[model samples]
Structures are given as structure tokens and as C-alpha cells.
Target: MNYFELHIGDYAEATQHLSILEDGVYSRLLRKYYASEKPLPADVAIVQRLIVAKSKEERAAVEAVLQEFFVLAEDGWHQLRCDGEIERYRSGEPERKAKKANEEERMKRHREERAELFTKLTAAGAHAPWNLPIKELRERVAALPAIVSGDEPATPATGPETLQVGEPATAPATPATATQTPIPNTHYPDTNTQTPTNIGINTPLPPKGGRKRSREPVEEPQGFVRFWAAWPASKRKESRGKCAEVWVREGFEALADVIVAHVEAKRDQTDWAHDGGQYVEAPMVYLNSRKWEGAEVGAMHQRKREVVI
Candidate 1:
């Protein structure tokens, strides 16, 4: 849902009559729609807040686009095109995984072929010294056929040494990878007397003060995103990480649609509105306490939850 292609000609055709401002609003709405992979809210005011609509004209345009392009259902405002794209992306997960596997296999074969060629040159006392520029060596090896077919590789003479060429050497232990080519681990003298140990490639030394490693970004759940959008964005919206954790930990994915709808509906209630949401619980509190279920909520929370689940 993070990415979806837009056919420029098709989009232009559909929105040709829309004003510049209206087109912009439509695009933003699509972004929010795909990002969460959820329907737009039936509530126009909530949609305006989600899309950051500030101007009177912009707010009006939100209504126009939703009316023209989106259909309001019991769940929310659903766009046929957006739903189709999201469904297709999710359904193609297996194909994407297969493509990644094929790419990795290609890289592996490339490494093995280079290793075989390297071993051949080493055994023949060829001029492919460890000190040769890696780029040049790689280029020369690349020009050669993958397996040399039904013939032996021709030995090229270097000097009076008359060393054999193209004779396969002992099997290479393993090869350097594209990401990290195996480089010589051992030091070699100018005479090239010692054989270099083909091991890990040379990695760059750390900077003077050292560098801080960065952590990977986390992908929030779609339901959590919708719930978060509905949650008031005051200082009370803390511990977002914990809230996301609890979201899945409590098996809320099944109830996410219900929870988000309930939370949005309750946003205007007396308990939440008192003291400017001072009593409006943090997301974690709201989720853990099951505040969305009103009085006598325990029985109703379970019964309704069972139906949704």
C-alpha cells in the first residue's frame, strides 16, 4: 500500500474537469486512502483533519471529490479504484517473494562463476595476481564464457617463466558476494611470494569519532493507523510505540474496524471532552481499558467482538 502506480493519461482524463485545488485534494485523499489501505471516513470533517484541509475552498473540494469518486458504505467511503489497487498488491505478495528469491539466486550464480575462474587462473600461475586491480580482473573474467563450453581455456604467455595457464586449481572455498566481495585476508609481499587468503573483502574503517548505527523504521498496522488518525492529537497521544504493540498483542486486528469506528464516534462524548481531553486517555490507556464500549460494556464488548472476530 506504500506504493501504487498512477497512469498519468488515465488520471488526467478522469480529473480533467476538476479545478487545480480540487485535483490536489483528490490526490491527497488517495494518498491517505492507500497509506492506510482503508476507506476514507464518512465524516467530511474528520477527512478534512486527516488531510490537513484548512481553507474553506479546500474543505468544499473534499466533499466534491468524495461525492464524485468515492462511495459511502456502512464501513466508510470506499473508492473502487483504490480498493482494487490495494487488493492486487496484497494478493501479489507471493509473486514478489518469488522475484526476490530469483534475484538472490542470480547473484549467487555470478559469485560461483567468478570463483571458478579465479581458481583456474591461480592454478596456472597466470598473471591474475592478487595485486591486480579488481576492476580489470573482473572485466577480463566477465568477457570469458560462463563455462568455457567443450574446450579448455587458452593459456596466455606472460614472460620467460612459461607458467601453465587455464588449468583449474583447487576448489575455491567460497566466493565474495556482490554486496561484499571476498578480498585477500593475508598480506602479500612485493615479490608476491605468499598466497593471499581469499576471505572477507576490505571494509572501510570507522570514522574518527565513530558513527551511530540507525534503527530500521517500523511499519504501523493499517488498523492502528486508522485508530491513530481518529485519536485526538493532543499531548495525550504518547507511547505510540506501546500502543501499536498492544494493538496486535491483544488480537485487535480482528476488531480494528470496530475499534476505530467506536473511537471516532466517542471523540465528542462528555467523558472525552471534559477538561480538553485531559481525561481523554492515552491510546494505550484507551485500548487497554476498552473505553470504547460504553456502560455495561463488558458483556456487550465480548458479544460484539465475537461477531466481528
Candidate 2:
């Protein structure tokens, strides 16, 4: 086990009678026990080396702590409380892993279900719900049952109209034309007519005509779309708009490769994969937090090699 629970009250009660130095030594020994995931060495010299006890006072403290808290068992020197914690951790590990796996499987199924629904909606000619205004999307969804059932047509009739089956068609009579009356014409002067008086005033010629500066719509880049697709979905999925805004504002398009690489490298990390990925940040949150910007690619690789060595 890499970790063990240390209840403050229990710890204090156990070490209450020990001196401060003895308490420190006891704490160090407990850390070694958990870190090594085994019993401590029975030899005092080896134990001193493990706890880094050098000075005479420190050695004395170590001996006193061991006498008070540890037992010389058949295997080695063991702390009963530490042994109990280790037992609990070992016993619970399999159950914890099983639960995590089940949760991950459940989440995977949920994502597949959503993807299927999105495909169906798109095939039905409904605009992508993610791209539609929330109210409009809700209305479409509310009306989807009727549309799918064929009970209601896509377009409703405006008014009732019918054709008679047995009646013969009748021709309508034309109306008489009215006589025309002529009237005098009224003409208006053109606004651009020349002025009678010549004025010697210098006027700035109108700025040379040029093409209008029209701003084309900001299209979502393919890289961002790919990145979004690769990102694990979570409750913060709705924050995609905010994420896109940040991506544009920060000009993250050029760094898309870097972001993707960072995500790939960190995806399987304990922090990201823990709790069935519940700890993974939303795409927008991860980007806005600048997590991808600080990826230590070569450094991580070097550390991995060192660990293996």
C-alpha cells in the first residue's frame, strides 16, 4: 500500500505519553512501515539506518519508541496498529478496483448511448442540439414524439380548403372597365441640379471608394473539433461554448498538437484516471487552466527511464 489512514485522535492517544523526540521517531518508523509495505528490521542498527537516527539522543528516542509501540514478532519488528491498517488496505483493494471498473464501464455505456441518440437526431434532420439555442432545442425535442409517430405533419395547414366531387365547374362573368380621365402633369426638380452662383471654396474629395470591410464568420477549426472529440466527456460538457471562446481568444489553434500530446500523455495518469475519470477536468476547464501549456514531455520520459533503472 502506498497510503494508509492515520486518525489524529488515535495517533495522539497512542503517542500521548512519549516525549516529543520519541514521538518524532515513532512517526518516522510508521512512515517507513507504510512506505516499505512491510515490517521493520529487528536489528537496531538497520532500524536506525532506515529511520536516519544518528545522534545519541535520537538513537535513545528511537529505542524508547520501539519499546513502547513495536513488538519483536517471528518475522520482524511490527507495530500492531500499522499491521491492522495494512491488513485493511490489502483486504479492501480488490473491492475498490472492482467498483472502479464497474463505474468506468457504466460511464462508457452512457457515452455510447448519447452518441447513438445524437446520430439518430442528426439523421432525422434536426440541427445538432449542441449547436441550437437551448429553447429551440427543447421545443424540437418536445415535438419529436409527434413527428416520429407520423400523427402530425412537419408543416401544419393554415386553413381548410376542399374540392367538390360532383358539381360542374361554372365560368365567372368579367367586370366592366372604367373610362380614363387625363390630368395636368406635376414635375419635381432634381436635387443634383447645378447652382446658379459659382462658389470658390475648396472641398475635400470623398475618400476613394474601396471594398467594404466585411468580417467573415468565425468558423470552428478542425483541430479544435478533433481536440474536443478526444476530450473525455463529463458534466462540464455544456461549457463547450466557453471553451471555444477561450480557444479563439487565446489563438490555441497553432498549439493544437501540443495540447493533444499533453492530453495523451496525461490521460492514463493516476490523477486523471482515478475514480473512473471523475477527477478528469472538462475540456474547457483544462484549456482555460493552461494545463497543456506546461507539459514536460522529455522530462517525463527521462523520469520514467530513471524509475525503471
Candidate 3:
């Protein structure tokens, strides 16, 4: 069984043996030993053996309860074995193995998805905005060491020194590590001790840096993906071809200048209109038109024939 049960069984056996002694002195000694903290496992085993092998008087006293003691000892060891098995089962070894296997599968799937996303983004020319190349990312990831390794150096500098190695000399110990031992508690009179400072109860939080500072909430722009796709194509074409071109030639250039100024003043993007990312450029209007031939219709006379007859 477990350590607790084993201890109890040993105690029971010892008490039974002590009870059998005819002289109260032997029993009294055993009682004193039992009342004290029990010996360690190794010491208890040695003591048990020594008691059995000693003088005939001691042996005879112990032999009276020897049968019951042997049975209890056997049962205790058997119980210990069973407890060990239970502990092994409870340690989550089986679940951990299964979890590790699942983790590998998850990592594989993530890698595949990332690879697919990279391919798609590169194809769409979206990777340029992110600035980190895929090859550089891979190299950085590869440079990281493994999570666990057996032969890695220990924390303390206790390893053997090699004479031939071109290693830098070790620094002499400063007062830092040696002088940092814990201070022992000392009794202080309640009256003599200084009172704690009356600190402010609720000081405001300090401004955060990096990510916390940069991440501010903003309204997301709203729109449908192909919202204008259902609009009349002829009308749209005409608007683009004539109306927009005329408007631009007349005042569109001036409007562009105004838009650039507004962008610079309000949005802080000075070269927004001139930048390659800008949609509106030197080409005044974009027209998508299709030419189609059709038959002409003739006008018909509906009331002329009857008057002639």
C-alpha cells in the first residue's frame, strides 16, 4: 500500500509484539520508542531484523507475535505495490502521450495553412505591405534552439575546466550572490516599531507603451463588395465617358489640387493623390463601353389606304 498504510501496519505489529512481553520493562521501552517519531524505512527494516536475531529472551518475546507481524508486513508491501500502480495511472502519462500526438497534428495543420496563406498573399502582391520576407521569417524561426536538450550546461559554473580551450577567464565572485542571504526574524516591541506610510489608496495607472499605446479603437469603414455591379451599364459608361471627362477638364484638375490639400491638412498624407497607391491618377476617367450594331425601324401609315378607295 501507500506510505501511510505501511506505517500504520508496522505500528500495529510493533504494538502487538510489545503487548506479549511478560516483564513490563520491555513493554515500556517499546512504548517509548513507538511514542517517538517512527524510524525511517531503512532504519525500521534494520531494527526489525535486529530484534529477531538478538538474544533468546528478545526473540521469544517477538516470536509470540511474529506470525501476525509477518502477515501484516506482507500485506503492507502488497498494498504499497498497488498504490504505486495507482499513482502511475494518476500521473496522466497516457493522456500526455495522446496530447503530444495531437499537438504534432495541430502544428502540421497550422504550418500547412500558413504556407497556403503565404502563397495566396504573394500571388496577390499583399506581402509587400508586411515587410518581412518568407525566407527571412523561416531563417529566424530556424535559429531558435530546441525546447529541451540533455547535454546543455547547468546553471552553476561547476563543470571541469579544459586547459587548451580558448575560453575567457571567469570573473571573481562579487558581493551580489554571497551577500543576498535571507535575514532572520527578530522580535520588535509594538510601540518602538515605525508605522507603515499612509500611501495614496488609488493612484491612476501610468501611460502604457508600445502595443498598448499604438492600439486605439477606430470605426471600421462600411461598404458592399460588388454594390454598384447591378447599376445600368450604359448609364455608367456615359457618366464615365462624357460627364466625368468634361467635369475633370473643366474643374477636375483644380478639384484634385483641392483634394490633395485637404488630405494633407486633415489626413496627414501629403502626397496621397500623387502616390502610386492612390486610385485617381493623371488618366481623367475610366470608361468601360461596348459597341453594338442594330437594325433601324421605319415609321408605318395606319389610316391612309381607306380614303383613297
Candidate 4:
């Protein structure tokens, strides 16, 4: 444990008998105890070393405090109050860890489920069903028939024509006398312009406007472009894609102004601008480390005052 509870009333009552020096020694010993998450050593010399006691008076203060607050046990010198607190902290750890684990798993499952739903909706050409209410979107998704690749819809079957009573059944007609003439092949000859007799029946016609020479370029998102323009440039530009991924993942869009403010504030700092921004970190590195998360507007103003003075 990095920390432990210190009730003011209990602390005052426990140390009322000790001098100021002894009280300081006691506090240092408690810190060492919690930091190690174990009891003090049984040997006074070992305790002195653990608490880094330097002088004869300091050692005496430590010894006096230890005797008053701690009892010799099988393991070491144990304080009843500290032991109780350790027990209470340990007893609740498993439940707290389990709760954290459960929450992480739930979030993972939700992201996966949402991604799957979004993919299905997009494939079906539904226009942004993800923006709809969860219940309604789910209902629409459920109403769609299961789609299987490489499968076509079934065609309706037609029944044979029936003859009236006492009417003779006619023989099958010849192809020449049939009501409709079947095209020679799948291709239909051009009737309007017939100069090209050498053209094969399977030859495809030229496109009306001609084939496009190149594909249109894909456009990047305007928000990301703006952010890139504002960020400080450096040689480490390769990680821009990764930095953008993290930004979108963490929802930095809502904090755009805050991030800009942090960047502008840091620009004038001694460490960042010491040698014409040579010491400044790359834009990608800054974004990846989430530097803006802890930046304080007030702290920046204070630093500005300090620099001026």
C-alpha cells in the first residue's frame, strides 16, 4: 500500500505523550511501515536503519516511540492499529479488483457489439443507423433477413397452360413460326448504323464518354487537418496516423480548445522554446502522451509571470 488512513483524533490521542521529535520519528516509522506494507524489524538497530536515524537523539526518539506504540510479535514489531488497517485494506482488495475487471470486460463487449452492428448497417446501405436510438436500431437490424453470400433469391415457378373442355391440344410450334423471334445470340445488332460488318457479335461497344484516366483523390477529415496544421512540426511525423487513432479513440474532439490552449501555453516555456523549439517534443509524441489532460491554464499564466520576473 502506498498510503494508509490517519484519523486526526486517533493520531492526536496516540501521540499525546511523545515530544515533537518523537512524534516526527513515529510519523517517519509509520511511513516506512506502510511503504513496505510490513511490520518494523524486531531489532532496534534494524529499525534505526529502516527509518534512517542519524543521531543519538533521533535513535532514542525512535526507540521510545516503538516501545510505546508497537508490540513484539513472531514476525516482527507489530502495531495493533496499523495491523487492523492493513487487514481491512487487504480484505476489500479482491472485490475492488473484480469490479474493475468486470467493468473493463463490459466496455470491451459493448465496443465489439457496436462495431458489429455498425458494419451490418453499413453493408445493407442503411444511412447511419448508429445515430438512431439503440432500441429502434436493434429492431430494424432484427427485421432484416439474414444475408448469405453467393446466394440468390428463389424465382417463382409458372404452371403449364390448361386447355378448355372439348378443345384439341395443339402441337408445339416451330421456331420459324413462333410469335417472338429469338436473337441470334445475346448481342443485338445496331440497326441505325450498320457500316461495320466485320465487328464480332461478342465485341463490346466503346463507352460513350470514354474511360476515366484516374480515380478521384480521397479527402481527409477537416478536423484532423486543422489539428495537424496547428501542431508543432518535428522530424517524428511518421506516427501521425497512430496519434490520430488515439485522438479519435479518446474523443479529443470535444477538448480541441483545451488542447490548443495547452500547446500555445507550452510554446513559450523555457524547456520547450529554449533553443528555437529544438527541445520541444513532436506533435505525435505530445498527443500520444496526452499532455493536454493535466495542463492547467492558471499554471501556464503563473509560469508566464515567473519568466517575466
RMSD of each: 26.7, 18.6, 39.0, 15.1
Pairs clashing in candidate 2?
Answer: none
**Quality of model 4 by C-alpha lDDT:** 0.65
How many angstroms is residue 202 displaced in model 3 relative to the true structure, after the best TM-score fit? 83
Q: What TM-score would candidate 3 get against the native?
A: 0.18
> Which of the predicted structures, 1 or 3, would earn the higher lDDT when compared with the native?
1
What are the runs in model 1 whose C-alpha is more than 4 Å off? Answer: 127-309
Better of 1 and 2 by lDDT: 1
Off by over 4 Å in 4: 103-309
- TM-score quality measure for candidate 1: 0.40
Model 4, total clashes? 0
Candidate 4 TM-score to native = 0.46
Query: 109-222, model 2: which lDDT tens digit per residue?
Result: 644443344444444555342223334444554566666536678686743234367756655666555653333222222224323322113422223452232333456775
Error of 1 at 145 (Å): 16
- Give one digit per residue, the lDDT tens place, for model 1 in 229-285: 889766789887778878778756545545766676567765776667777767888
**Per-residue lDDT of 132-221 in model 3, one digit per residue for the tens?**
334653554344343212234435465536434887777776777766755432322133332333212342333343112232223211
- lDDT scores for all predictions? 0.69, 0.65, 0.35, 0.65
Number of the top TM-score candidate: 4
TM-score of each: 0.40, 0.44, 0.18, 0.46
Per-residue lDDT of candidate 4, residues 1-309 (tens digit): 756778888889878988999999999988888777789988999999988898999999988988888998978889888888788879999998998799768757654554455445545655332234445556766766666111444454433455577878777766765576433333433534433663455656545644333433334344455567666655544566666676677666544544655676676554775765577777767777877644432332233222110
Model 3 clash pairs? 1-79, 1-80
Number of clashes recorded per candidate: 1, 0, 2, 0
